[model samples]
Target chain A: MREVFQQSLREVQERLVKIAELVEDAIENATSAFGNSDVAIAEKVIDDVEEIEALAAELDLHAIDILARQQPVASDLRLVVGALRMSASLERMADLAQHIAQLARYRYPESAIPKGLTKTFVRMAALDVEMAAKLVELLRTQELDVVAEIRDLDDDLDELHAKVFEKVLSDKLANNPTGVVDATLASRYHERFGDHAVSVAKQMQFFLSGSLD
Target chain B: MREVFQQSLREVQERLVKIAELVEDAIENATSAFGNSDVAIAEKVIDDVEEIEALAAELDLHAIDILARQQPVASDLRLVVGALRMSASLERMADLAQHIAQLARYRYPESAIPKGLTKTFVRMAALDVEMAAKLVELLRTQELDVVAEIRDLDDDLDELHAKVFEKVLSDKLANNPTGVVDATLASRYHERFGDHAVSVAKQMQFFLSGSLD
Candidate 1:
């Protein structure tokens, strides 16, 4: 019976890592679609989100099942609960990526990003994708060091997000108001993608350490 | 033992309602503060968020405790899990309200909203508060009618949010880029506040029906 419970726990962890990988791929493809106005890629990302959502729902039910059957105690209990939380964070992260893809889809043939701010957005996308990949690693390993790197990448995304706004708001830049709105909102999406990665890392920490801090 | 479990479950519901009320109040005050540039109100809202956070943390642990001890099955299990999800949603709702307050506090004495968009924002705030209040009632009653109202209100908010962007991007309206950014992001915040309320309502429905649809 103990072995059965342990196997279930391990399977839960494995599925979580798989979900993280799916989310990571979505972010990378979505950002690329955003930068290049690649409608095909953006459409694929949007279509793939359904699979991510289904996986998240499945993971959630599986975690709850573990809680019901194993009636896990102490650290084991925390791990199951943390699985639920991490599933939620990853689900929201995927939604953010979908939003980015939708923008790319909405403005097909014409990039949502303006010319002057394109480089900054590209950099933001790179940082966000890097963070998402790290999230996959952290989920697989539950290492604290990986969490720090993901947070640092989030900080970089925030800085690039701010720079996008700076260029749009700069007197020298000649961005129209519509383009400015698109850039601001898209930057926010990338920045929020990083934020969710950081949040998931924190959930992972809480699972391992059993500490809210 | 059953009575003890029942009492614990009721306490969790009460606390969840309390968090909802706090979040509702935060949205109301945050919006008013945003409109009037009232630093005192904004500051108070920001400070009050800490209490809301503490209450949410307490509720989560209480639910987890019920899970560990009672090991509730069937509907009881669903109730506890629902409590966890609702607590998380409400906590996030409060954070959104706090973000709105911070924007107001950051731009105190000088309103974050521009002149032409102020009325639209005020409407969005009114709708958001109404939705938050409905959420409180829905949490208490779990009635489907309240959920519909909340969804309708969210639709209203989404419309207003689009209008804010339209005006900012229009050739007729003259908005400074900074003010535009503020208005755009602030409106997004209010719209998202409505979205979270709708999500919680869905969670409530799921709890009662055991169906995700």
Candidate 2:
């Protein structure tokens, strides 16, 4: 019976890893799509959001079933709870990415970003991808060492996020006022995506150590 | 031993209630302090941030102690976990309020808001106060019915928040560009504070019935 429960739990974890990977790529592709106004990529992001949502639901149902059947105790209980919370965080990240893609359909069809400004956004995306990838790797391999590293990597994202805003409001949009508002909000989305990805990492930490704060 | 664990949990609950009340007031005071340039009010808001942090640490210790002493199962375990997550949310709400107060200090001694748009910020403050008060009431009582109502109340805040930004960018800054940025970010702060307060209400929902999606 315990083996059955563990198998179901592993299934949920595997789906969660897939969800995280999809979210990571969706945001990265959507980030590029918006930067370059690629409609095909934007539409793909919206489609991915549905898949991410469905995966989240499946993970939840499976988690609930395992809980009801096994009545997970101690560390097992924490793992299931963390799986639920982490999937929710990933689902929201997917939604935020889709929201960014939708902004491509807003007015000002040909607003070009200043040279090299997309670099900051790309870095932010990379940070999110790194965090998501690290979380999945940690969960799948059950590597405790990676847990401490996740927090350290978070600082680089914070630095990049701040630099993105500073560069946006100062150098990039000093005189180009037409789509500055949209660009400003774009910066907000990037930073928030990074935050939510870090949240996934933190949830991974909780699953491992059960010291969530 | 179990009775003592219950007592600690009860004390933590009471402390969380106090923290909620204080946070509600802090959000109100932070915005009022911003709109009015009231240094004293800003100080009060900042002070509450420390208090909330201290309470959060206290609650963390309480959770640990209860788990160690009682080895609680079933509903009792869920209650402790939910409380831990709720207090973390409360601490975050308080931190955001504190940041708003800090922003207020930068806008003071300037009277920077344009003549016509100050009323919009005042309305924002009123919204903040309304939601904050409602959340505190819900936290104190832990009623699911009230939690559902608070969820509905967020729609007004959402509309107001959107309208405030629209007005600000369209013509609200025709005269007072000096304080326009300050007013813009401060209004965002109030809108976000309302969201956080609603989040606390949502956490209360989880504790009440275990359904918050």
Local distance difference test values of all predictions, in order? 0.86, 0.70
Q: Write the per-residue lDDT of candidate 2 for residues B1-213, one digit (tens) a residue.
A: 667777876786787788788888888888777778787898988987898889887886676556544555555665665566667677777877887788777657755455566777677677777777877788677777777676666777777777656765665454433334445555666666766677677767766776766
lDDT per residue as tens, model 1, A1-213: 999999989988998999999998999899899988999999999988899999989988998898888899888888888888888889899999999999989888888887778788878888888888898898888787787798888888888887887787886444366677788889888877888888889888788888756
Error of 1 at A121 (Å): 1.4
In model 1, the Cα lDDT at residue B206 comes to 78
Q: Which residue pairs in candidate 2 have backbone atoms (N, alpha carbon, C) closer than 3 angstroms, thus clashing?
A: none
Stretch of 10 with least lDDT, candidate 1 chain A: A171-180
* DockQ score of the complex predicted as candidate 2: 0.19
lDDT of 2: 0.70
A1-213, model 2: which lDDT tens digit per residue? Answer: 777877887887788878878887888777777777777788889998999999897887676566555666677766776676677678878987887787665533664344456777667667666776776687677777776676667778778766754655564444443344455556666666767767777777777777765
Q: State the TM-score for model 1.
A: 0.96
- Give candidate 1 regions above 4 Å deviation: A173-175
Global Cα RMSD, each model:
1.6, 4.0
- State how far residue A39 of model 2 sits from its true place (Å): 4.0
